[model samples]
Target: MNRCYKILRTVALTPSIGPSSIKIVGAQYFARAAIAAGEFNSTRDYASPFDADGHGSHTASTAAGNHGIPVMANNFNYGYASGMAPGAQISVYKALYPFRGYMSDVVAAVDQAVEDGVDVLSLSIGPASVPSGPSAFLNVLELELLFATKAGVLVVQAAGNGGPSSSSILSFSPWITSVAASITDRRYNNSIRFGDGQSLIGTGLAPPTIGGVFFQVAAAADVCQRNITAGLVESCQDADPFIRSLVRGKLIICTYTFDFESEAATIATVADTISKIGAAGFILTMDPDIGYEQIKGATVTLQVPRVILNNMESSSALWEYYNSNTMRSRSGIDIGFRATTRILDGREATYTWSAPVVASYSSRGPDVNNALLETADVLKPTIMAPGSSIWAAWSSNSEGDQYIKEQNFALLSGTSMATPHIAGIAALIKQKHPDWSPAAITSAMMTTANFSATPGVPILAQQKNKLSPTTPFDFGAGSVNPSKAIDPGLIFDTYFKHYVQFLCIVPDVDDMSMRRAVGVGCPSKKTDWCSDLNTASVTVSNLVGSRKVTRRVTNVGELDEKYIVLVREPFGVNITVRPQVFKISVNASRHVTLFLVATQTANSYTFGEMVFEGNNNHVVRVPIAVYVSSTLGF
Candidate 1:
């Protein structure tokens, strides 16, 4: 039976939108599989394409899982879960196992997926870093994707988790659509109210204690009096050391340290320890040495009332309150445990209604060329989508994060979660406009993204611990607007040959490398400038005095429309577009020239946009990024 079908047998979901039917097809597993024991099993090769790790299932369902499925875990209904395209079909190509796999296996999977005639290819994987080459764009993975694009497959990939840092994008080829992660309007928070009437906020997904009344608190160190334990006994790892009488009805405080991060300790074990000792509930405080939202399995559902103080300040305050109230002897033996608190039921959901913020972990870009980090004239990630705290399908095994096991659903985060949103949206577009090329589809999305928001509210990006206005590097064309994209009046389409020509002109790439990468020699006629490639976005990594580039836009709408060009010029560059106002008939194309001149030398990158607003309610936007080196030098 299909893996998804097996899961539906257990879901008591009254699905409104349906997966109606999940027919598994073209299922193949090419990599050596790894089971839960962390041992490689060669005999498992060519087995069923079942998701041993929940990550693949989460991503797969995010793109095309059945809609209106109630997200249930720990016997609590958090909310309804849905995919971008519920009616779409899924074909599994298992390249990597739950734990890890080789790049060669990944290559085989991509090649096979393309051969199997899949419409869209969504990959939540990429190179660890910039691949070794004169031009990182020519790596084996990039070349395979280039060929896939040539075969009319829309490839979407994770933009890497390297983060708010500049020039950290891993997706290099313009042919592939790279995706950045964003936090959604939904927020998950739990609070603990102390006896003094002060409440401290924390994170968790669990039910509240049986009653609303405050319960006495007990420290793990006091209850688990293990004088000769090997690990951090305060972590509450073992039930043997616990003084059950003291912990039976109290909210036990457990320490979260690096051990939890390394899997030496786990939230599952802590929950087990709490159960074994019959404690009323548990509070996991951050170990000062490792603070901030680094708690793994923090979102896992616990049957017991639980709260994870992920922030240092909140953990410190809770600790301070506990220490001040407790009376201890000179030898540090607890004489009295007086801290009292009640954990609120966190299973209920809440909405912030705030605009999606670029996740602090999503890789930013100026699309670099080499390992030295020379910026390239390409934009990445091409778009952004909700990737943080997303609730999606999970394999009960939970092989990826062992701390979370035997759950049919999971709340996960990463750029990996974002990539499939674009892929699913692209599939919808392809279904509507069967004749549209991959480039046309990509342009439609780029030009119409970030549309569903209140006017004048600039989308902000999370930097380290602060929020700032996002740039093209932070979110390519902004968050994707699927509705507007389906009717984007104008699209900048690219040809496979254009990519070949662009590769020939890349800064350090040579003819020999080009032959090896693409299986073809450079065309006799050399392209004048790399920026001339017809893409929805324009970027000049190192601009000097001035440069002129031309872009051709095709009318993809049903009627002729007149459009006026608008420019939000970059800080140090002045822009001019000829034939500012023009009309184009349906199925026709128009070429526009943009003249950019250096107004002042800017040592850093500055951002801007060029918009084409049509009379027929179609808006096309193109992001521009430029780094000015010198006013008069190359």
Candidate 2:
């Protein structure tokens, strides 16, 4: 059996025997059958028929191997050392051809993993952006996954590193468990320092003004006297030479040329050039969309130790500063460039800092459910986990390859890291209860899952930035708690039959009110598809009101024991559980009536926990909701 949350620490109980317990059906990756048959190297070439790369190797290690080490790239691996289910056996069957694109690969992989007897399939890769349903990949790759659910196999996919919004259609699918990114380390970066407190908000060089002088190189005397203005002629001015001269300390005012998103690279190039030429600082101007002679560069600040100026407005501000002293402060602002980590000596450079939160360029989602969100049905990420600066096993062995160590690993981030955690967790649950079906496993997770690390605290909506009670959206059903998941109080127990029912049945207000009884969505005005009770349950019970209600329930277990039933009020509804006692055992059952009198202002009253113990001890809670006045109002 797979050791829960211990994939990389040690060899599994029967490492030599391998994971013969789990079976892969559809995809070759999940089947590792070829390896069992002495067909391939389980770790090095998991994605066979396609040349090997390092990514798949690390993933396989955490999913099955017993050892690992860290490595860095433009990225790094970030998350727990071992995956959620270390004991679960894994095999990578190559479906999509290498570099041919993911369009056909995803479908073939899923189909074969199921065929290979894979009880659980985990996919760490996804499209770069939220996919539109109209896209070919969506129609082909994603649609095939919809069929995987019917096959009784659990499918998990990465939510995509692109934040908040990545849980949508192209990248996220309802059939797959979407994963999100979170931070493990609280400390992100060291403070940035700049030399000479006096900073400039540099402007960009435009056509005619490209010749304007801004600063003199402290080291180059003759070059300082050189009237670089002559070099500003339309025929002579090119971005390269102009940027080069500026680096040499002939403070060249220039116009901003690419997207602000590339500011980090742009500044790095200019700063490196200047440092090489003995220049102290730069006055990078932001003269976007203007002519040379007609426009003056705007100012922005560089966080580097270099004395950089920020160009907020026009060069007129600099002229005003140089020409006058009585001015307290001109309208100047600081503009910063976005930066990425620079790895030196196998670690991030000290001057370089890890980004707090996620990169702004990283897209966010589920805010306004588009195609991706619709496919996900808003069941996503479930929760965020460490996805940045990650190090994982790799495959390549070429001399000059980035991933070549016998214990090859590389750093990476994105939903890729997040998906493995869930996959591991699913494996653990399967390990513990081998007889449980996929729906039972998923239901146990969704219902019993804790929804928040900080309970009762509100997290603002990503897009709106508005503070509201966090739901499945912010921290889906609370973050994934493996320990808690192992023993969920009440499992939802849904099946594909329910999915078919959802497709065919139309629920009435009774069904509508029943849905509102649970905490999925608002009450429907009339019968609507949103009120589908097929995939979920229709809770019905009278447990509302501030007044305490008491009742009794018999224990139904193999042996005798004591049972206690309690209730905690939902929002706006005040409630208290009156003490009750019931004792029974061996094929017998009991019932409890929790009396509740909801306050007039209490809009909706929900249910709480019903504790059980003794010979048959299994903690469980039932969901019950009471609407205010019962007069339908949306």
Candidate 3:
């Protein structure tokens, strides 16, 4: 299901309005220039015409620009949030429109960005999957993205909120950049409370024949009331025991429903009904289903003591009891119910903005549709960034809603939240290498990426236990390392023409229909093979052509900087960098590069360093694998 739930959140773009919102534009010519030129500009002037969401500003500054804050962007100007590039300029473009023409406008804006000389374009929006039509709306976007590669623009798009599964498809443009959002170990404090109101309370004592128990039935819309009010009252299927357990005048346990009613109306109804019925508090169960809003119709009145069951903890018990045939037959002392005026406070729970792994909501890769899959089989999103509970500029026009008063800052999640980080980094890279191609930039960042685990921490699920490192489904190519990307010794560069050639080699793709899907002809593999296409080809060339790219560091203790580098084509690869000594000058820096030759497979390698000693104080290892064509059977 294209739904968001289970700690997974989406980064949705707010409706474009004033300062609090995002405005999008078209980029019809952007991608083309990026591929051709391999270089662009990233100016950092806050006073530009596009002063949209501060999200871009924050991400830009952290990844590349020179913003001077420590908390939000981490003071590096290109610090914590400083993307792969630490010294790039920034160009702000506000081309997004309201919900109505969002896609068309945004795509056009991307084209425009290329025309305006933007080397990288980042988008935080996504399309809904409607199956009854073309493969999916995103598939169409993929075709348009081809124009970007032709234009030499590197497009970074966010993975959708539909996640925890591989069903979701990232935008399938060969040259369009795709990114997924990851949670960090950061948190924020917030709370929701129930209001007070009159309530009906039911009281009943358990009989010796049955287990000890007390029952209550006080509050708005109890079971009996719902049946009778509906007139054609059936015996409230599967609800008799729940009802009989409650006493006539005491506290009664009942389910709450207010999703359909306005917040104000629901509150008013609860107050009036509670006063008339006379009841105590209530106990509510956490929802098990997933969605943008998992808890629905949960009405808690402050007038009564409300008890909440952590569904994660109580689900097992509820399931066991619910399945018992004699649950309702258990005898108990019959105690009359009662009505009363009482109040209770709501429970408080604060959620963290960052946690390990991708939010259970960000979409996955392996774009279906043979015709569309050919361009880039690269797993999405291309990388991960902070998209959970990120604080950014909020629209000023949203103050009218009772639940939300207009504020300068707002918290959001989703690929929308991560895109700005990459865009900012693009600017930084531009600042350093004004003539670098989008491919060169992306390749540098991806190749230099590391997959080392943190010290004193065991990989865990729910903060406990450890799993094997092969869990690619959860940690794609491991976590992203921006610092390493800037200086990646080896790169896995991809070009638009090469990606298109892969599509033609697919056994099931309909060549005639491919044109309709991507607006391009499939290259012929026979005689006039596309292997010679004028695209940037990535092959397993010798690091130094037998020269062996090597370096020496002599300022440290006599330690074996013993290292191992291997390429696993598209399947598995490993890279290790070990220092043989432990002694070094306090104010000196050391550097080295591990190289992995690329094979004919469209894959990349990861790096890490296993601790030879028990002290756990060594840098992690990494692997260098570049994506290559398997047509020649590498």
Candidate 4:
């Protein structure tokens, strides 16, 4: 794993595992485990830094996995595996355990990582929902992250996968870079062919090819137990002897019944039953009411060909064929099977229908933190990354793992997969510019992100597979462009104190909680609220007429550089910047005030952008969103 990731340091903080178990080439290793596992929490365990669950290794390797390692899955070589920052080094901190980890253990890990002087912290875990009130302040993870940010460590966290729903982002704190998942160019497209010359498209992993092999198909209902209970045979859940006898040497069709959906219709359960009964193959049809939509990836590995038919029309036709009179008179219907094909040799293609779309499960936000206060609600998923079906290094020890077969590399998906990409990018940026602050690095990435791959077309969403316009809430500051980010002419930077001030402006958050969070008291003077925040993005809510927002930009480019402000005003809103053109010397900064006037009240949120173009072709863009009283409730 170290050879693949170019790991600089491998640290083990568990009592059970040590440095010897963690194999890394040319990497300094360290171990520090708290021996008193039960002292911190009852759930705590003294485990080794070795990744028993395989998640830690996956994420770590995704961030800095070594370059040019052969990538294989299910004994099929796909390509070479490399991380986003393969040149960068990784240092592991074993803070998690199988399934769960104690909060105290995680805090200890964070404290140690910060103390050890790591450049960037990639945490793939988060609460399912935003914590409220004092709980928010008391959250050990958030508090530790605050300290890390204060110490100039770039913290990247997963915007939890509880998504496809608005306000589902869990890492709500503004100090950390919360990432959302998006589909990459690569996908596993499986095809199913029937004897009727009709073919259907589906998705799965390691589906057996079975090259033109034709087998007789039978519905599970046709192989019911004699005198079976009502609905038992139809559900196809039990492994009864009669059902097994009927299914042996035949492809079985499984459909979702009420009992199956409620009790036994998972992919694992269905696949296990089919394998145990000696079925030649399995065809899983979607529930009729749910309509058509193929499950995107593999849920489990199967020895036999397994195809999921999500299209309602195709599945309905198959169901009819299974119960047809011709089939009833005969022993069973003949079916032909073909395995999924890998397009572009499983390489990513950005311009295709599936490319550059937000993963259906990626979290969305108009961050629910401080939801009651219009000014305090922050935009989350600081950015999107390639998170779907990413191929990266896997733990060798975790054989028979559900996510990773006995291979050096595995394909996985989640915001967890996306967070490390940014972390690795941050590490690269840090290497290029050692003096840059975390906020400056964040601004560089955000201000220079590409919103669309093609001209006049915004990035598409994977779930809808359409080119619908998305908002900042959908993809905050668009997607990260590492090459452009390294030389962003100007950056909107903020310090820890700025966040404290912003928090102070939040309604219902008391000073006591603020002190507990930042270890600082609110200033005597009132903060400018959200207007004072110098973020790369601008948001103004509940605007009745006009409001002035102050922002400062620091020039990080050549000396004597001049930047001209270009405003794309939101609909019904007039935007003007005082001193539209300004000059700044290297290492110098300038402040600009934006005067916004609402020409008409907006019943919904409106969006625009301000572009600062430098003479040298360096551009820094800031997205602007405005909401009127009618839309303030959001």
Candidate 5:
């Protein structure tokens, strides 16, 4: 076993959780026994649930780690970190290793977690692609989650990393609350001031050059005596070419190009090359031909001071400044390098209000009906949360990101990061309402999410190079709102039978296939279809003329309240709700009927919403998305 397991086992055996300064991981005194579901590395090393890869520790701490723990890295203190639900207990179920994982092991972990009576399950992993089966919902992992949900465990999964593309979602089942990634209000920005007094904002997470001293800058090509072939030296990938005398104590400039993206060169390699050559720091300027630049993952961790000018304009301006200040000899060989710059501290965080935008890498919707790219009526990415640049607990020996191998914490991004936010919040909800079903908890969160950025303005999504208005396909109910969700006055509750019925009416799935998948046949009489699954949102991929929908709500609050229904119709459809206003007593249920009528055929899907304003300070929102093909049957 690894040294981390030895430490974890020692900590686990201790009866007391101790104090904040004790440096507790996710599992503490409240944790049960850690279990490994299968053998990995061809060894019976399955007994210990030690998180050597760091993903488990990162996700677990993101969900329910101890509160007010200081996040220290590289001799700098970022700040205090806390999980969404700090008081909740945690149990490790090791299923994946650093290199690879198998579905059989994941299934076993799910079965074991459910059997252990865990109230909430957070999965930051998913299939490489949509599962190949009769239906994506019929896959073994999805069915295991279905059974877990039936047993009252709320399951949350990552929507996948594929995004900004249509039908790129990996989590397509309705029972699972798939989460999408979004940018938070926090941002880290660094700047470098040239000797000419001009400054350029860039990305890095390291301290400023020591003592406010401006370091002499040199280009990798000029300092290296070797002939520049294919311009590989410009990226500082080779240490053999550099002359230690010219490079020592100088800030070196490197080029970031398509080569970096193709894995031919990497930031880790650049950092290693600069460190070995005794350079004070480095700057990575984008090659204009690389088009859009993306610097993420472990590259964020920098031991040496550095700046990555990631845009064309910034990179071009820097190059112009460098060339003007630099002096080359007549033979274009030995010359006086006069360029100088100073890097500023970048570990500090800056807060802004313009965020919660859907990340460019978060998977998008129009949940697929099967593996064939067919559309389903259900909305994908049940909700969005802060996923970009999230800092949480990490194992020092983690192999997930080599650049950050020895660090105890990592700032990462993905739908994987967003999922634990919901899972932790769900733990909070479950603590408050022990009797609520998984669907009720899901409905509470969905119906109370903030669909708009501000008043009358929709939350936007990052579409490749720009931001655009979004729909239910982008973020199901919108970004999650923890404050409004806990006291969601009414919730749309679902049961195991509802999911079975959902499969029964799937366009291409017959009762025989459904039975073969779930081992349960559909009911003899069925009045519901795919779109009428009683979720918090309404979606119709193809709407001809009109459709009638009914929703049932249960008031869980203490007092009786009256609610008024308001509608914002979609572009090509008119929506009407019956009795526009109604009152209900505590614990009472009400049925709301909605009728949608198409006025004209729309070339694309349009978005709208139905809101319920309660006298008791409760607002319930239901999103509507539809593609109108015709106003009448032709």
Candidate 6:
């Protein structure tokens, strides 16, 4: 805890009614553990600011961790570690307890954060499922976030780690900046070299020095007890004492059945058994359905060398060698393997085409909450950030429990890791532009984000390691570029009233509940509820021919700047802007009408974008998505 405090001076450890003037405030533990232990928590506890789970520490450090601290994971050094905004102070709010969190506690924490005058709120937590209709009001956290934005605080949230699945984003409130997880350019590659000169690449986070001389190889089934069940033995699940003698000096080969329930446990059991029996090494084989993309394994300190073979062909070759006559005649087959790794240290290399892709676990979105609203189908995951295999500060108390070792730093992956990166960037933006509204700050970040890190190469998804084109639903306005975000020329701005109008338009949202959420009543003229929403991105679904939408933008750059409108029309759709070019004075605002006309009847969704390019090199880009209905008429 002291080490973390060194990174920032204003870190609040406990909730206090200290001077309201204080800029940063932290509440250690807002939620108490449930009476019964579940997957995320081990026991019940009281409210405190301390992080016993290590997640809070990791996220806090990622946001504003101290600069120039050497970090390592699984015995591999990753050089110095620093947060996205190392100079920014952080207020730690510990709303998450162990693995579980109570909505009441989360709401209380947000109240305290707002009262303490925090400029930015970073929440790496959310509801477990999609929020829509009346259930949306039940989201106390988001309701509090609405109040926080009203109080001039920018809230950044995790997009949830449920991805490769459409409509998986849970944080759908347009008032909050939802973040998705993306891969960094750096990756840890662990390879295995066989005696026959056959080599295969895989993923692991153990020490790179776990390779050497060849050892005898034996299948886990061959070494299991005679009385053991065929199913259990074939899966290599249990590490019984009887099988220890057989695998004592050989490399154990284990196969995964791809059973989601038992796959993880099976791998752990095999690794534990190998360590106990003093095996030279272990080789993990994937099911045919698992695919060839190497899955990042857990970070562990292993006594023996271990490598995974994600390719079916490689696993087949090894199996064939193990079952060969030469190996049957002997006690076990001789095998050669080496596990080595290289660290990129955060340098951008064009030769590497695998990174900056959407992580398979990072959530996708179409903003399910907006499905019920006629005009307000908002896009989610305001932006993407590097979240996979991130190294950050870990709680010393949680060492060896949640973390692999008793160290102040650890490597982790999730949207939880991505949220703080945006939060830190938000902090910088807030510091630079203190008067900017939360929506303006979000607009700046969204409009200025880069679609792809490398020119001409579309951002890819990590699932198949392919360069397939992704949608705004996959990555909203693209990945965040902090440098560009700091100076977005024109920002799409909104206020609490706009969001309240948005909620009023929600099909089933009650007026009383909406009043409680925004502390206001629905206006008498609510006809233009959705059209009144001013955001950076535009989405229009079920369009037959022509549809018009209005967008208001405020010039935050130089006075009397002219921005030429550039439109990339979606397939089967022609977008025309009235008054093709516009000029705005400093701090002045302008509204533009966009006419989206379908050139031909279409049955699918199409995507395009509009770029407002200024002569001074300041560009404000807005993504446009249109879905044409196959039906001819309404």
Ranking by lDDT: 1, 5, 6, 4, 2, 3
CA lDDT, candidate 1, residue 121? 86
- TM-scores vs. true structure, each candidate: 0.91, 0.53, 0.52, 0.84, 0.92, 0.86
Off by over 4 Å in 1: 1-22, 32-40, 43-46, 132-135, 226-231, 238-241, 258-265, 289-294, 370-373, 451-453
What is the C-alpha RMSD, rounded to one decimal, of candidate 1?
Answer: 4.9
Evaluate model 6: give its TM-score: 0.86
RMSD of each: 4.9, 12.9, 13.1, 6.3, 4.9, 5.8
Q: Which candidate is the best by lDDT?
A: 1
Off by more than 4 A, model 4:
1-46, 133-138, 207-211, 226-238, 241-245, 256-264, 292-301, 320-326, 329-355, 369-377, 396-408, 462-468, 508-513, 524-526, 630-634
lDDT of 5 by residue, 508-616 (tens): 6778887888889888977465778888888887788888878888998779999999999989999999869999899899889889899989887888988999999
- For candidate 6, the 10 contiguous residues with the lowest summed lDDT are 1-10
- Residue-level lDDT of model 1, residues 1-634, one tens digit each, is 0011111111010111223465344577765323333444654432567666677788878888777999877677878988887777777777665335655566777788888787788888876667544557876677888998998888888888889898788776889888999989876789999999999999888888776999989888877665746346778888888887778988999989888888889898998889889988899998888865757788778888899998889988998999998989998888898889999988777898888989998999978664335576788888998888889888886455555578788888888888888888887888788778889989999999993357988899988878888898988998999998999999999978999988887877778888888888889998777788899999887788999878999999999999999999999999999879999999999899999999898778899999999999898999998888778945
Model 3 Cα lDDT, one tens digit per residue, 317-435? 33233233112224422232232222222322235433355655556554433332332323344555656555444333332212122333334565666666666555555555555
Alpha-carbon deviation at 22 in model 6, angstroms: 13
Better of 1 and 6 by lDDT: 1
lDDT of 5: 0.79
Give the better candidate number (1 or 2) by lDDT: 1
lDDT of 2 by residue, 1-634 (tens): 1101111111111111134556221123322333333434535444443325445554555455442333322233323355445555665655322222333434555666655566666666655444333232224455566556666667766555444443342244444555555433332221111122222332221111122222332211122224444323111222333334434434333223443334323444444444455444433443434323211112111222222223345334433443332222244311211111111111222223322233211234342233322332234444444554455555445222321333345444545555566666777787776665566666556545443344454333333232234434443433456776676533445455444333222222134432332223332342223223321111222222333322223232235666565554544454445445555564454434444454454332232333333334555433333433432222
Comparing 2 with 3 on lDDT, the higher-scoring candidate is 2
What's the C-alpha lDDT at position 626 in model 3?
Answer: 26
Rank the candidate models, highest TM-score first: 5, 1, 6, 4, 2, 3
**Candidate 2 or 3, higher TM-score?**
2
True lDDT of residue 67, candidate 5: 84
